[model samples]
Target: MLGNSLASSPLATLGLAKCFHHSAGEFATYTNVLPLGLNSSHHGLTGGVGTSRNKWIVVCSTTQVETSSEDPKTWEECKEALSCFDFSVEEKDKILGKAFGHIHSPYWTEERAKESPKVETLNQILEFLRSLGLSDEDLHKVVKKFPEVLGCSLEEEMKPNIGILENQWGITGKSLRNLLLRNPKVLGFNVDCKGDCAAQCTRCWVRF
Candidate 1:
């Protein structure tokens, strides 16, 4: 074991920090990401197990959505499979007991945008969450409230990976993260890489 923070971190353990930092870049600067397990995956070596976040706090959307996955990679397929639905925010309790935002949206068909009254929103909530380095417990709570605004929505066509979500995941986490990075408007989630931006992103992530 290379190291372990009181909280989890992408590079918590020196065991994989050297390699993980080289690839994922900005997604590993945090002090809360844990190396739940080891993997001798694709590179003929260890890869992220992707099971650490096996449980999710499913964020409920105010509109009709077929939420099959929230993994980065699978999100594309989900959007493609999606048919347009009128946007609306759902009601839910607070997370970390901190006041979170969820504005009502008459964000309806392209036709209604001009007429409907706009409201406050959580467009950048995910970014704030990542910056704070919230614990899994808090994260699960946050995700559970905003199904409409997932940090990373899954692709409708991605294959299921039970080892990842432990729930009814017909998709994987990598796919979900992909979706998160791609759809910044929904969550504004950033991938924190280590070494390069570690010093800077860390300061920003914390200060924010």
Candidate 2:
């Protein structure tokens, strides 16, 4: 069902260009500028310029270059990084496509996209989820629905939220799995707010 839904998802139609429009003009301008000692005859001189978290970066190469803070990972690279997982090619594509669609969301930024998540960190997340009894299919569905989960801190956001659900509200086993599949975004909710009424209400609802 998740696979079928992804096939018809609007994110499937969106391109990297659309999500990274903020840097389009800058990229075009830098690409056209010839580096010293290179002329129009130098056919392979490719360059890109953009800002990440306010730091300006210029990348140019005759061949492909490594990703840096200034040049974060593309959607393709993000998918490739997840190759260690058991996801099908189509599933990987759909997952990253949905993720790229959220470039401007508070959880992600244009600059962050170029760098992407580290392989080691992603592995930790997968392992943690597996420890909670999530199967490969469940993992795929959760990531597909809320790809930003990839960006959440393992110890800070994910662990604490899951802990609250299990320890405070007794939502474990099948109920926990069902809740995650139904709304993975709940893991990102700020359930630790001390005095906020909204957070208190959320806690109340969970207890009920």
Q: Which prediction has the highest lDDT against the true structure?
A: 2
Writing each residue's lDDT as its tens digit, candidate 2 over 20-56 gives 3135356422221222222234333334223333232
User: What's the residue-level lDDT of 30 in candidate 1?
Assistant: 19
**Clashes in each model (backbone N, CA, C under 3 Å)?**
43, 4
CA lDDT for candidate 2:
0.54
My TM-score estimates for the predictions, one after another, are 0.18, 0.50
The sequence of per-residue lDDT tens digits that candidate 1 reaches over residues 61-146 is 22211112223223222222221222222222121111212222221112211111111123234334444344444444445543
Q: What range of 10 consecutive residues in model 2 has the weakest lDDT sum? A: 29-38
Residue 198 of candidate 2: its Cα lDDT?
Answer: 45
- Local error of candidate 1 at 156, Å? 25
The models' CA-based lDDT, in order, is 0.28, 0.54
In angstroms, give how far residue 30 of model 1 lies from its true place.
Answer: 32
